[model samples]
Target: MTEPNGTTPSSDDDQIRKILETLLADDEDITARAVARLHPSIKAASSITRSESRSRLLAEYQQRQADYRRWRRRVAKRSGADTATSLADKDVRIAELEATVQLLTASHLAMLRAIGELGGFSKWAKFYEHHREARDRLAGFGAIPTAPVSSMPAEQGGKKIKR
Candidate 1:
């Protein structure tokens, strides 16, 4: 099969490949419009180069990415075994911190249940919600709001504190 212009597909592909190599050597962008501008004889330059040049660009980009990963691995090795040890230590520290947070959450829930049994949960919830809202409002003013007196223990509870 041949184009109306009498050029065969394989021949057109060969031409496109050669043009792409020239573009690469010149360090210029390998685009259909650029190819057409350089060699107008190749009719429908985009369709001709779509299969040829796209794979070439994709391979180049993949090579660059692989080079970057290899460079990072080399740098990490140069930093020595201490960096690996510190990374392992950080993982352990993170696990310990997560466990501590779980324990604190359980304790907090137990305390809330005890307060609910004493029928003081409603009042506590109201005060807690109001405190959060006040804190958020004060934050916009760049001020740190103090805890309300109602949030204190029964022994320390007193009249409501104004902001």
Candidate 2:
């Protein structure tokens, strides 16, 4: 039988036989030494390839972890900044409101002191005359009228009293 390349089976077998015969004819000790050297070289090459691949993988993983940590820190910083900004704005609003309340409280206290300086009845009468709505509102709540006492006595000794 002949192979597709047109070499007879016997001729092909003869070539393989001649090659093996030549290899077998070499000194056994020399062949063994050559094989031993070649084996160690192949093993060293494989080990170096494995070590390079492992080093590349380790470097890639470390870079990825470092990038992730940096990203998390950036996000945390932004959140902290946002919180600080919001707190600052809220503090400003609270300060403005406190100032407004203080002003209003001062005005109300001044009004009360001014009214108290006058005779209570005269103050209430003036307030009723000027602020009819406030007087009506107060009257709706049934507020009691107050009478002021004078320092002068009314009658002294059964005679008419003098001013």
Candidate 3:
């Protein structure tokens, strides 16, 4: 079967993969929904998300990020690079760190939100329960921080205040 562009299904898939790779390389949002919006012709974005291609790409990107984090940590340890040499260097480094933190936080919150949307709190809780060991490993690696929920300062409605 061929797509509307007279390309075979595999070719169409290749096109989609290329677009996805470009989006990832640019550090742009490439959620299935976002991709569908950006390219209206690809109508099966949700199905694509469940496909092996999407999973592979996501895994690859995650591995790259993990490698980057390990490299940065190693460099920091070797050079004690946490201290900036000048005020301008400090400002630039602070901005970069802030952006990284924000990106990681946003990615995590988005995943949590997706889980909630899929099956609410019960599913979210179940997910954590199922992944407890992996989560602990991540925390141990310092990829994620372990903090007590009660220790967080709450706002008026039980929501944690963002610092």
Top candidate (TM-score): 1
**Tens digit per residue, CA lDDT, model 3, 49-107:** 67687556645655665666666676676544443444459799999998897787667
lDDT per model vs. reference: 0.61, 0.50, 0.61
Candidate 3 clash total?
A: 0
List CA RMSD, all candidates.
16.4, 38.1, 17.7
lDDT of 2 by residue, 1-163 (tens): 7655666645533443343334334422222223223332222323222445433433444465566666667667777878678779999999999788667656754554456555354655675698888776654543423343333335668875877
Per-residue error for 110 in candidate 3, Å, reads 56
lDDT of 2 at 149: 31
Query: How well does candidate 1 match the true structure in TM-score terms?
Result: 0.35
> What does the lDDT read for residue 57 in candidate 3?
62
Candidate 2 runs further than 4 Å off = 1-78, 121-163
Which has the higher lDDT value, candidate number 2 or candidate number 3?
3
Q: For candidate 3, what is the lDDT?
A: 0.61
Model 2 RMSD in Å is: 38.1
In terms of TM-score, which candidate is stronger, 1 or 2? 1
Candidate 1 whole-model C-alpha lDDT, 0 to 1 = 0.61
